[model samples]
Target: MPTDATPRPTIYDVAQRAGVSKSLVSLVLRDAPHVSEARRDAVLAAIDELGYRPSRAASALASQRTRTVGVLIDDFHNPWFVELLAGLRSVLDPAGYTASVADLALETASGRKPVDGFLAQHVDAIVIAADLAPGTLERVGVPIVVAGLRELGARDAGRAVDVVAGDDELGGRLATEHLLRLGHTRVAHLAGHSGPGDARRRGYESAMLAAGLEPITTGGGATTEAAGYSAACALLEAHPHVTGIVAANDVMAVGALAALRERGLSVPADVSVVGHDDSPLAAYRYLALTSVDGHSADVGAAAARALLRRLDSPDAPAHRELLALDLVVRGSTAPPPT
Candidate 1:
């Protein structure tokens, strides 16, 4: 057995063991096409036997590619991004790309630009999962894939960006329609100002209008749980007759729950509630929030694939993909109280 001090194996050793030229070993390392199958197999076998690991730094220097992707998220507190990151890794890992994660919350707290951090890492590409300041992405000079966001306005206008997102508007409509189907006549929306939040609000309004019911909406600031709670409180104060609430996301839905509890209201019994983003919190026995599943993981995977394609064909027309959404029924929604 080799001790900790044993020197790591190198490509030269691998080439010698396989009795192949170093250039041939390099081609095999890159999985390059047109290499003879027999030579490729020999190189791979020798690499396995000798435990030779390619130096990513050296490879990057030669190819001008770091094989790293910067993933920017809104907040770590939100569980929605957990599945999204898993999906991104699913495709990126197999493609030999590493995901470097950063959250806007922390970046702002530290008083640094999120894009600056990603650029400093020399990432080959960037996957945006959060909203940035206007023009924050200008002149990034890197391929960008907007993940899980239906709209993004901050980017280099001259460059084409790939977008892979869930149909948030449809998801919002589905959640509101679910509540409407559950016999809720007085439905209010806990709104947020973000792109997804705005889209969801529009969906709720559309459903209510279609049903010929007056729509009540409140909260147009943050999408945090605190924001949800505050908005719910304000909504209940102004429209206490509301029988249902459609929050922008699961965290906000939880906030609304707290607001309901304070007013001695029971979920689905007093007021049925539906939330968007079927995050892990929605599945908790205590919450059991009926929510819209935007398939964020699938969005992440699709975004990664788009990023790879962008890398391969930089001049191709920008890819825009909108994934479908579904709703997960839980304990939070039911027929309105009699």
Candidate 2:
């Protein structure tokens, strides 16, 4: 029997085998609108025979639109981000746009700039949460929308970049006020770090001042369970009289609950606690955490919508949207002991 013959194919080989011009082959590979279906089909068939893959860089240069948005999150494992992503997908999926996510774990020691990777991919736009590394805006060539974050004074190439955020300060105030209304005078706040944390802290202070009470903050970094636990322990040690606590986020609140339990304290009795973010775990029957709803889903959806608008009209005016916050009273909170 004759040995079977096989041929390795390149773009040039596909062009020749397809009996089409190299330019036509290139256009088909790039999915350029200028090429007709008949020629595209012919080029595709030749590509299948040769097992040829088009160069992504060359194709991207030919087609200006990548149909992809870059999303950079501070941490990937956070449940808040998961909910935000769902909201983002609800808006972007129907519009045929996709997102590329970059997670920057606080523990990562790598000096690699994740923003550079997104730029290298030629993503059409970028959505970044709070606490982004400095200089990200300067390097990004495409439209950038700040989600759940604030950019103090970054130039936007004369085109206004959009920002979508929740009223974290208001949420903080609401949480504090709720605790105050429950007759808890010595309420301690487990404040998180940076951005949202600062805003919420301000609100807590404002609410306390308005109520003619002093604001006490147990400063903690990030909204982690460990941070909450540590902050709660510190608060209990410093101010044993404190009867209520408002954590910056649900994670910290859960930690506070655990801390209270470890101390042989009961929720809503020894120390009523309220958390921010209203994460899914907050609603569990066992936890029943009273928390502030930052409406992360709405913020995510608004960010996606803002990005699409910018993509459609790059020169459109810069916009800022602030979503509302609601207080969800659950079983975790109660009036201080008489």
Candidate 3:
């Protein structure tokens, strides 16, 4: 090992030298469990050669609890995950828990299962912010908190998954209500194919029925801007009189804008638009889209709380929380023109 006088290296440096992810290094250092001998040896060697020392927070977690939580995201490409991650860290860091993020996109590309990676590190708990493949959590012997959009848990009796998420269904209803309140009767929905997407579409349909309007839906595909654009084109082709649109998410909503512009339509002038997630993209001066705020940050914090609660009482009654959602009116919505 290097002397105390030697410059200490960060975990990132150790990860680079070890040719492994930072979470793997953390697992090696803690000696929590389940790390392969080769990877553990490599990490140990890197630490000795580079004079790596754990942080004060990391050092404080010397207990039965590994004090680590694995955060699984659906895809790293989506910007909405940024705020949710920040919220998780905000509470986790202060509570002396390290949050390590991974994504299903990367896992599937490498032919690795989502839980396999976390299980290898022996994470004390897991936060599922994505809809994982079936069986990903079937036998995962750890406390799990399903955060954000998806509803997931164990199928077997005696085990339950704790869930904390924004009211996505309510968000859809709120978005539609805002457009309806603005005198938009010819409203269409840019659909997304996911648990959250399904809930949002149901909300839109319910609101439309309550208003004595028909629910026109399109794009039960991926949750991307491309899908949004394709959906918008289909909607416009079928119902050229559509005066408003409710997208599954902010990125999808942005996609709708491009399709609208191509058809000689202007936002809020020719057709009002609304989006979900209230991501940074929605607040851009150019987009300025009316959107539903899911309070992702708050949901993240609450999810952490739920995980901690579960960790303390594994046999306790299952906890489910859905934060209220609100619509943020911006420049993207206005009354339909005569």
Candidate 4:
């Protein structure tokens, strides 16, 4: 009684092909605990033979759950994001979920909006890897896991959200302490933008104060190389005795290197420098910049796991995960000039 014009293979077709009921096919697709291993294998084999693709939209309409997570990042140009994505994918892909990345190009300022497209797609949850704009969280209906920024409070919709962040303060302390240990008392910090920058700056100041050394800070907005170069110039002019610099991120540290070279200063000879976020570029033989590892990949995985836990129980209490930091000593740091 099958018509030639019948639509593409559905769960019913897969069930018939596998000699099982439609419910069994459904169970197999959902990876339900009740389904036997043999039955699941048979259903999968039948699906492969029939070229049946599960309709995501249809499944969502029936079960009111879309096994997808929305990820919004502040910027994509930074290599740190690539590592973060690797971590996120490792956790989500094995769990039968997909992450839709939405990059808000902060450079243009116009493209700096949250994942409105993903929200329109009705993803099951959202992970924000950057600092969101004011009032953006108010509109989000699904469970949210915020990484990178830690200040997002409960939403107006009464939906609790989880936050994941690196120990940036500790990272800053480590970087400054490294320079201090190398006998550089006149150290300066190239701080990032508002959120993470403030914490790092605080750490730098705390460390400097503990050493009885005056703390100097220059703005390295958004952790960019250009900003680092400009900030380094200002810091050098103001504090000529500064023999050490702690940059908020690797990009800034690289910029500081260029600035120092342009001024006829040799790295680790005239000055020692340290950067945060031990990005891949920092390890290059030419750069060999010492940096603090923010463990961005671990943070991403933690964020995904937290979101999954929330998806399992929407009423679960809010959680906060802070990844540990590590200091990577490299060629960029050395004892101050005697």
Candidate 5:
């Protein structure tokens, strides 16, 4: 009997199986913190078992506001966005706002405007954490918050844009100073093309000069692990005596690691390496990378706050916020071999 007996299960089925009301399940789905842990677990388990998927269409029709925000990320390959998204949802969920994320890298490949999809869905605002090409953000209409230091800026976009980012220059300075304090003077910086990359490079240079040491910077291209490896290879070949390196990000730092090993140098013993982002790769016991924590989550939360404020008062002065950063010393960096 191939009747409608196996009609797709709904939230009602989930609630009944979890032995709870539909409202409780809804609260859990919304990630409301007030839900008790035990009940939340039961609801989630039931959802998994029944394979119940929430209908965003139904959700939008019921809510007064579209309550959807668009988040534009630079690259899906970078893990830095993981923490940023977590911080974003922490505030967004409680406010009944849902996030719709898009990758700029993928969007560009399809030759579509980065925010076109969001506009079609009528998102309330957009968070930009990517470097958009010229005119890509022209007359976007929605409230826009530039979430990180990228090649793209509000002024360049020809629109008033709120900005919330980590002070990347400070992060670079902290990393260099940490290595300098550990008796390493010959330090090199692996460069990239992003806005934060330039700021970090400048910070490294200034720190080197302050100590009467010359700075060597290279690789003004992509910020991927492969680019880092290429830059490190060139740096080591040109200046084999270089004892310390500060890469643009953790992935790049991983690249530097391989370069060092190829040259038969031991981290912190023969050469020290410091990376930015403090990504999961940095924390791996095998890596234990000395890194700079830009407080990405805090930056994301601040950006969300800025977006909310702009939504409330579109004419208010565009907010500019730059959270401070700090260095996390680990086994990857230490005094140069004496």
Candidate 6:
């Protein structure tokens, strides 16, 4: 029946140990500026001695702010999110904000709404990095920022939301144009269903039309590797003479690689491949895929900055920013075999 009854240390205890007023201790915990180095050091040392942990819920209630941003990603499996997240943290961490991430794919698997989870946590704001269903953002009382060139849902629920994204349509055009410049005539695009994917597809089509060539498009909906492989296989079966490919993303390009190898074709020697996002996979020594660099990290940082702006001026008109993209040539692409 014995039970440990040691009471947990509180902020008052920290203030006593640090020999500072409760308000000064609070400022130190909040990391406010203008605090002297001596008092800050003493407060920190006292916190360590007492092993005191601040209560986020209590803090939020006191200040009416959580300073936490809920970031919803399309899929965690895609490495593209890695750079974007790093970019977001680069700005957010120094601003005394934290990011709480959730994956759309996982949320769907669990049959729960992704945005709902963020709201339940009482997050101060939400960053939409995934293409969510219509009305998903409806009735959500938090501020929002859409990242990575994705559109707000059909509901126009977030018409006032700020957006910071890469110029994906330009990225697609750059990838396709690279192959065209390499003397590739028969080019096929593996399209994806997302907002960015659709824009990239349009760029490819526009480039082909401008060159007086017909655009060959494949991939029904998803942007996954399996989808890419299947789309590539179908493209080869139908257009056996295709000499170049533009995949919607890097993973899809890798999928196309498998399909090409299975068909006994060599990359660059027989055909060339280009991908979007310029993810880590593209730089691998073995893959070395020619890819479109969307500067995902920059997009993330910009998005975080935009979110801060939205929080500061809730009444301000919505803003949209598009960062340009470029192509990185690598071993995966070359002039079509003569």
In candidate 5, what residue range of length 10 has the lowest lDDT sum?
1-10
Candidate 5 lDDT (Cα, 0 to 1)? 0.88
Greater lDDT among 3 and 6 belongs to 6
Model 2 Cα lDDT, one tens digit per residue, 1-338: 11124443568898998899999998887778978778888898998877776776445663577788888887765677777777787898899889888876742346766676677677888888746655656745688888885533445334488889898899999999999998999988999986888889889999999999998999657678898999999988899889999998988999899889888889998789999888888888999999998888889899999999988888888998889899999999999888
Hey, what RMSD does candidate 5 come out at? 13.1
Q: What TM-score, to 2 decimals, does candidate 5 have?
A: 0.80
Q: What TM-score would every model get versus the actual structure?
A: 0.81, 0.80, 0.80, 0.79, 0.80, 0.81
Candidate 6 C-alpha lDDT tens digits along 24-135: 9999999999999999999999999998778874455644777889999999988898899999999989999999999999998899777878876778889899988877
Best by lDDT: 6
Give the Cα lDDT of each candidate. Answer: 0.89, 0.82, 0.88, 0.82, 0.88, 0.90
Where does candidate 2 have its weakest 10-residue lDDT segment? 1-10
Tell me the spans in candidate 4 whose CA falls farther than 4 Å from its real position. Answer: 1-63, 106-112, 155-158
Decoy 4 TM-score against native: 0.79
In the range 1-338, model 5's lDDT, one tens digit per residue, is 11233676789999999999999999999999889999999999999998777887444553445899999998999888888887788878888899999998998899978788887677888999888887878877778888888777677657678999999998889999998999998899998879888889988988999999999998869999999999999999999999999998998999999999998999979999999998888889999999999788998888888888888888787678999999988999878898
Candidate 3 weakest ten by summed lDDT: 1-10
For residue 148, model 4's alpha carbon misses the true position, in angstroms, by: 2.1
Better model by TM-score: candidate 1 vs candidate 3: 1
Model 4: weakest 10-residue lDDT segment is 106-115
Candidate 6 lDDT (Cα, 0 to 1): 0.90
Q: Give per-residue CA lDDT, model 1, range 146-234, as digits (tens).
A: 88663475244457888898989899899999988888899999998887888889989999999999989999899999999999999
